[model samples]
Target: MTLRHAVLAALLDGDMSGYQLAKTFDVSVSNYWHALPQQLYGELTKLEKEGLITGRVVIQQGRPNKRLFSLADPGTETLTQFITEPSRPSFIRDDLLVKVRACEVGGHAELIEQLEERAVQARAKITLFDKLLRELRGGTDEETYLASNSRIGPYLTGLRGRAFETETLLWCEQSARVLRLRIGSKPANG
Candidate 1:
């Protein structure tokens, strides 16, 4: 999917300044789609020019003016159409995966280190996603929140993010363990 679609979908929540959009993407959208702040700013300009998103300048004392953006009619229509289109299947293109595939040739130590590092990263994200999900649910249990909340898209995506990280942590640990075993070495920290 294009960044256009991601930006449009993000604006679905409400009007947001470019900075706010960037923060939102960093916390939530980064789960499914990744974009740098500069990329988001550029796409915002393009979307505004194309009339897919509406932007209004907000003046503030002691600060530069900021443009707040919201989804226009065309933007909503674009997102709707995008939703109806078949999504291309997602695939892994991770460099770590490639290295693991070739591990038999050499570099078991490096590969194991990389895998353990990835596991740590995944654990961090899982903790973050857990906190985010709790905040999104707002003291409600997941079932109740899902049933009662109208704006559950973010929560749903956060759930997916947590699950993804959890799986990543598991896979990384498993891969590391297998490599260590093959090399007749004890697992890291054990």
Candidate 2:
């Protein structure tokens, strides 16, 4: 998906300045679509020019004025059209995965180190997703919230992110353990 679609989906949360949108992306949206602040700003400008989004200037007492954006009718229509279209399948293109594939040829130590590092990152993300999911559900239990909440899209996506990270953590830990065990079997001077 394009940054345009990600930005549009984010605006569904509410009106937000570019800064606020960047923060939102860092916290929640980054789980799916990754974009730098500059890219997001550029996409916001393009969306506004295309009439997909509207922005209003908010004046602050001491700081610089900010522009808050909201999705327009055309944006909503665009999203509807997008959702109806078939999505291309996603493929893994990670460097670590490539390294793991080559690990059988050698470099087990490096691969094991990278895998352990990835596991740490995954754990951090899982913690963050857990906190976000809790906040999204408020005091309601997940099942109750899923069934009764007015807005469930974000929550559902958050669940996917959490699950993805959980799998990542598990795989990384298992791979690292296997690699570490294999290290003991290597020849003394080979």
Candidate 3:
């Protein structure tokens, strides 16, 4: 999906300034779709120009005025249309996977180290997602929250991210173990 759709999804929560939206994306949307702050700001302008979203300037004391954006009727309609269309299949284009493939060309040790580091990163993401899940739950039990929350899209996407990271951690650990075993058993010089 385009960043446009992601930004629309974010606005569903409520109207927010570009800064606020960027911060929200970092904590929430960054899990499923990564976009830099600059990219989000750019998209906000595009969306405004397209009339899909509306922005209003808010003055703040001792601070520059900021524009807050909210999804317009057209935006909601566009998002509905987008949801109906079949999504193209997703694929990984990861450098780490390329390195894994190249291990046979002589970087086994380095590759293994990289895999371990990736596992750590994955674990950190999982922890952050867990915290987000808790906040979304807001003291409500999972079943209650699922049944009651008007905006469940974020929660659903968050769950997907958590699962993805969890699986990534498992895969990295398994790959590292296999590589270590192979390296350990190999002849000293062959």
Candidate 4:
């Protein structure tokens, strides 16, 4: 998807400054997609010029003036069109996977180490996803927003993120076990 769509979908929750959008991505959307703050600022400008998003400058005492942005009608239309269109087939282009395949004949140990490190990263992200899911579940003392967002794209995206991370953690553990077996080490669990 284009950065335009990413930014627009992000703004679907409501208006936000660029800083707020960056933080939102870090907390929610950073798992499947990523954009630098500079990229976000640039995209916001382009989106505004295209009439997809509009921003209002807000003054703050301790910080630079922030431009709070929200979707215009055109932005919503664009997002609707983008979402309704059929998605392209997914493809894998992971350089690390390719590297591991090539190195399998030379020294699987290094590949094992790389994959193990990836496991750590994936596990950490899974913890974040779990937190997001719990947050999605809402609170007894506070209102939950995700229920209201059931029809929104991020609602579905959150499910997909959970599934993907679960598969990643499973694959990591299994791959590590298989590599250990190859090296004449007992399975980590066995």
Candidate 5:
């Protein structure tokens, strides 16, 4: 999906300034889609120009005024249309994976180190997703939250992110171990 759809999805929570949107993306939306602050700002402007979203200036006492954006009626309609369309499957395009494929050519040690680091990063993301899951539940038990909350989409997506990261961590660890063993079995000069 385009960043436009992602922004619209994020605005579903509430109106927010560019800065607020960036923070939300970093914490929540980053789980599924990643975008830089500048990209978000640009998309905000484009969305406003397209009438997909509306922005209003909010004045602060000591800080510069900021424009808060919210999804417009047209934007909601657009999102609904997008939902009805079949989604394209996502594929991995990772550099590390490519390097791993070439591990037999040497640099296995470096690749293994990179994989370990990725595992650590994945674990950190899992922790963050767990915290978000708790916050989304709002002190309600999982069953109650699932039964009561009408807007469970974010929660479900968060769960997917958590699961994906957990699996990634496991894969990274396994890859590192295999690479290490292969390196150990190799001759010193070979």
Candidate 6:
């Protein structure tokens, strides 16, 4: 899907300034859609020009005036159309998988380090997701949250993120194990 669609869908929550949108994207939309803040700003302007979004300038005391953006009716219609239409297949272009695949063939010191870093980052994200889930469910207890499903979105997304992190950690651990074994079996000169 186009970045425009992602921006429009995000606006569905409510009007927000560019800065707020950036933060929201990092927390909520990062799982399925990834875009730089600069790209978001560019898309906002383009959407405004296309009459898909409207921005209202707000006066500020210290910093520059902020423009709060909201999805226009046309934008909502466009998003509905986009969602209904068959989506294009997702493309996979990831570095971590490639590094893991090559871990045993060559020097894996850097790759292993990077994998460790990714695992850390993934755990951090899972923690954040869990916090959001707790807030959504209104409690820390799993049974309580399960019984009350008022906030289903974050709960479901959090579970998905947690599962993804677990998978990533497992992959990293297995890669490290295999690489160490290979290193131990191979001769120093070989």
Q: Which candidate number maximizes lDDT? A: 1
Error of 3 at 59 (Å): 1.3
Model 2 Cα lDDT, one tens digit per residue, 1-190: 8999999999999999999999999999998899999999999999999999999998999999999999999999999999999999987678998888888899887777788888889999999999999999999999999999999999999999999999999999888878878787432223
TM-scores, all models, native as reference: 0.95, 0.95, 0.93, 0.86, 0.94, 0.82
Query: Clash totals for all models, in order?
Result: 0, 0, 0, 0, 0, 0
The reply for model 3, stretches above 4 Å from the true place, is 185-190
Model 4 lDDT tens row, 1-190: 8888889999988999999999988877876678899999999999999999999999989988888999999999998999899998877667677775675676677667777777787778778777766665556221345445454466567777878777877877777777777786654334
Candidate 1 per-residue C-alpha lDDT over 1-190 given as tens digits, one digit per residue, 9 for 90 to 100? 9999999999999999999999999988988899999999999999999999999999999999988999999999999999999999988778998998899999998899899999988989999999999998888999999999999988888998999999999999999999998998876767
**Which structure is stronger by lDDT: 5 or 6?**
5
Ten consecutive residues with minimal summed lDDT in candidate 2? 181-190
lDDT of 5 by residue, 99-185 (tens): 988888988777887898999899999999999999999889878998999899889999999999999999998898888787774
Q: Pairs clashing in candidate 6?
A: none
Task: Provide the global lDDT of candidate 4 against the true structure.
Answer: 0.79
Taking the tens digit of each residue's C-alpha lDDT, what string does model 6 give over 125-188? 8788777777766645777677775545546666886787778777776676567566664322
Task: Return the clash pairs for model 4, or none.
Answer: none
Query: Which portions of model 6 show Cα errors greater than 4 Å?
Result: 139-158, 185-190
TM-score between model 4 and native: 0.86
How high is the CA lDDT of each candidate model?
0.93, 0.91, 0.90, 0.79, 0.91, 0.79
Better of 1 and 6 by TM-score: 1
Model 3 TM = 0.93
